[model samples]
Every structure is written in C-alpha cells, then in structure tokens.
Target: MNRAWRTVFIALLTAGVVGSAAWLVFVSPVLGVREVRVVGNLDVSAGQIRQATGVADGKPLATVDAAEIEDRVARIRRIESVRVSRGWPGTLMIEVVERTPVAVLPVGGTFALVDRHGVVIEIKGVVPPALPVLRLDRPGPGDPATAAALAVVGALPEELSSRVAEVHAPSAETVSLRLRDGRSVVWGGSDRAADKARVLVTLLKRPADTYDVSSPDVVTVK
Candidate 1:
C-alpha cells in the first residue's frame, strides 16, 4: 500500500481500539460494583456506611463519584471523616474515622457523649464510667463553657484523665476538674495547656484538696 494509505489505516485502527476500551471502562457492566467494603468504623455499621454511599449494586464503578459518597457519609453525626475508593474489579472501599467522646453531658433523660470540639457524638441512657461528666449550662459546639470544659479534658494525660470524674466551666476563663477521689484542680483556661498539664502532674505528688496550675509559672496547692 502507499505510505499515506498505510498511515490512514493505522490511525483508524488506533481510534477503534481507544473507543472500545472507553466503552468497556466507562459504560459496560464488566467492571460494575458488586460489593461495598467498609473499614475503620467502630460505632457505625458497614450497612449504614454502604447506605450512606448511595451506590447501588451492579453500578458502573468508574462512574461512581467518590466526593459525593464522602459528603453523604459525613452527614452521619458520629463519623469524623470518610474516604471512598474503588477496589479495582468489582468492589467499593469505604474507610471511616469516628469521633472519640471525651466527656458526657446530661441532656434531659439521656446523656450526650461529646468530643473535644464539643460536638455530640452519641446519646446514651446512662453515662459511660470511662468518660468524665461535663458541667456546663449548655453543652454544644457554640457554647463557650462546653468548649472550655472539653479543652481542659483534652489537655489532660490519659492517666490523669482516667481519674477525672467531672469538668466544670461556668465561663471560658474558669475551667476546673473534680477527680474521682474528690480532689479539685483549677485549670483556668485553655491557654498554656501543655505547661499546666506538666505542673499539675508534679503537684499531684503532694497531698492537697485543691491544686491550682492555672498559672503554671506560679503553681499553688491548698
């Protein structure tokens, strides 16, 4: 064949191959999703995650929108974050990160478990023994008292936090903690949290009714 005819034939063949591959990947059901796998979820069930994704079985995997799925799953209150990815052949993988409750607040008959940002993670009939109780007028993300109380709780080391029974914050500047053993701690505010935590750790060595590490530079025990 002549050079021009041969070149034209090669171009047509390449276009045909590209068109077929596009059909198989984007339109054909050969790569359809058959299962949705959820992982890294503790409070949320796999079924719940799958339902939130809104991806029907046998849907074309390549056509699925990962950002849309993530936005839908994020609407679930307890979920901190969610990631959606395709598992090649016929699977959708959903990874979830759930919020950890730092304290519980009494809300009428039930109790609300809140995270460090004062976002309510869950509601329970009874308080969990491991979590400290928050003493505030209104416990929510917008409430300053709730924010202060949760901030103090978040700053505490795990060992100290385990001994804390209650966190009180009437205002943003007056945060305190009541230990399980009945001792009090004047935490003041969220500023210099690392310094205050260190000083408080050392002050607990001495016997005292109240430990004031509000001013970590000048700590006091009474």
Candidate 2:
C-alpha cells in the first residue's frame, strides 16, 4: 500500500524466486541420481553397461546427457543399439540390444562370428557349435554372396538351423547348405528366402543326397 513497503515486498519476492531457482538448479537433493538400471542385455553384463555409461551416482538427473551415455554404450562391439534415459527422482535407465551371431567365417586361424548383416561381431580360435560355418572364398561384410548366405541362415527356423552344419556361398547366385546328416540344400540366392526355407523344411522329410530349393516352386532332388 505504501511506496516504501511495496518496494521492500518486491525485493523480498525477487530474492525468494532467485533462491528457489538456485536450489532447484544447483542443490536439489531430489534431483540427484541414486541408481542406474540396465535392461535388454544378453551377452553384455549389467555392470559392464553401467561402467560404459559413465554416469556418476549423486549427479543431477537433469545434467545427465542421454545421447552421450548412449554413444558410449554403443561403442561396445557386441552391442547392436542402445537407448539411455533418465528416470524420475533418482534413476537412470539404459537398454541395450546386442548383436546375435548367426554364422562363423574362418579367417586365417581365427573364426569370425558374424551377424545377419554380415558384420563380424567377434572372433575366436574355435567356432561355437550353435553357429553354422559360412564358407566364402573371399569373405567381406559387404560382399553380396556373404550377405545372401547370411540372409538364408537368418531365415532358417531353429529346427532347420540345428541340422545345418555349414553354408556355402561361392557367389550370390550359388547359395547352398550342408546338413549335419550329410545332405545338401541348394538355396539359390537371397530372393524368396522365406519361401525356400518353408519348402526345404518340408522337403527334408524325404530322403535325398541333394535337395534343390533354387527354384522353390520347382525343386529337384538328387
């Protein structure tokens, strides 16, 4: 009401607003991260992901950079993709998708574990039994033949894949599989892979030295 009193009131109000802003931005206990949670990881351990994130405990959640954390986690060789988010109150969540190896390519003395995209995910002296060996004269991730063979391997149902010991791809047009029981499957190229897979699954029930799903509609057995 009075001019001096009004001035004092405005000054006090401004100080309170500034103080609240500072407390929220610089010193709020409720905004600090107390936990980091990891999800969707198979091969990668949760502790490894947490370490990769580089998010320090008790740091302000608002200051945590999701993009930076995701980029750091994505650097792991086995990780296919990652999503980092800040959970309200006191948690940071990280979700990771790891690359699944579908085949092994013998390169030099070591076998390179490759995913469906033909990207080499890992390498070791011995190939894993669950993965089929991929035979390519010159194996490159971007090679058409390698991609086609990988596509075929990726499409095979678990039952069918269990019986396949190796996949031979000399060229994009000549994709074939060698079964564990000594039968061969001529899979042709990557085209109509799902159809070929369906035909081959049914055709394998019969006895044959070689099964051709090269032209799945008109398959031949030898």
Candidate 3:
C-alpha cells in the first residue's frame, strides 16, 4: 500500500479504538453498578449510608459523582468523613470515618454525644454508659471550655476513661475529672496530658480525697 493510504488506515483504527473506549466508559451497560458497598461504619448503619449516597443499582458507575455522594454522606451527623468511589465492573463503594464520641453533655433532659473535635454527633434521652459526662457552663462546638475538656477526655487512657463519670472544665485552664467511685481528679489544663494521665493512673491505686496530676512532675494528693 502507499504511505498516504497506510497513514489514513492507522488514523481510522486509532479513532475506532478511542470511540469504543469512550462508549464503554461513558455509555455502556457493561460497567453499570450492580451493588453498592459501605465500609468503616460504626454507629451509623450500612443501609443508612447507602440511602445517603443516592446511588442506585443499575446506574452507570462512571457517571456517579463522588464529591456529591460524599457531600450527601457527610450530612449524616455521625460520619466524620466519607469517600465515594466506583468499583470496576459492577460496584459502587463508599468508605466512611465515623465520629468517635469523647464525651456526653446533658441538655434539657437529653444527652448529647460529642466527638473530640467538639462536634455534637447525636442526642439521646438516656446517657450512654461508655462515655463520661462533660460539665461546661456553656457547651458548644466553638466553646473554648468544651475544646479543653475534649482534649483532656481524648488524652485519657482507656483504663482511666472507663472509670470516669464526669469531666469538668470551668475555664480553659481549669479542667477536672470525677471518677465513678466519688474520687476527684484535678487535671488542670490540657498540656502535658500523657504525663498527667500516667501520674493519675498510678495515684488512683492509693485511696485519696483529691488527686492532682496537673503538674505531673510534682503531683499532689489531698
């Protein structure tokens, strides 16, 4: 064949290939979604996540808008973050990071569950046994006192947290903890939290009226 004809033939072949690929990715039913999968959910149910995504079976996976789906999923208060993606061949995948509750706040006879970021996750009529109650004069996401209490709550070891009944943050610099057994702990500010937690844990072994680990290096018991 002549060089000109050969070049034309190659161009037509490339165009056909690109067109076919575009059709498969953008318009074909072969890549359509048959299933929607959810991962990383704890407090929220998988069914709720699927509903939030607004992704239906038989929809084109390539056409699903990940950012829009994420926005929808994020509307659920318990979800901290969400990632939406298309699973090749026949699935739509949604991964979620649920907010971890650090403390609960009593509001008008209901309990508000809040994460370490001080964002309220949910409100329940009854307090959950696992989380400690947070005592702040004014509790809100932007409150400095709530943030300080959250820092201290988040820093506490699991062993200590399990024994805690309430967290008090009168001011940003003044934080304290009340244990389930009626013992009081003066935790002070959020600084040196790990050291303070360790000191408090050790001091809890001995019976005392008040345990002050605010200055971990110079702990006091009253």
| Winner by TM-score | 1
Give the alpha carbon lDDT tens digit for every residue of 1-222 in model 2.
899999999999999999997787557766888999999998899999999988777888888889999999999989999998878878999988899988999989999998878878988899898889999977887788988888888888888999999999999899999999999999889899888988988898898999999998999988
What TM-score does candidate 1 get on C-alpha atoms?
Answer: 0.93
Off by over 4 Å in 2: 2-15, 22-29
- In terms of TM-score, which candidate is stronger, 1 or 2? 1
Off by over 4 Å in 1: none
- TM per candidate comes to 0.93, 0.89, 0.92
Local distance difference test values of all predictions, in order: 0.90, 0.90, 0.91
lDDT-better candidate, 1 vs 2: 1
Across residues 1-222, which tens digit of lDDT does each residue of candidate 3 receive?
999999999999999999999888878877888888899997799999999888767777899899999999999999999998877988888999999888899999999888989888889899999999999998988888888999998898899999999999999889999999999999999999999998888899999989988889998998
Order the candidates by TM-score, highest first — what do you get?
Answer: 1, 3, 2
Regions more than 4 Å wrong, model 3: none
Candidate 3 colliding pairs: none
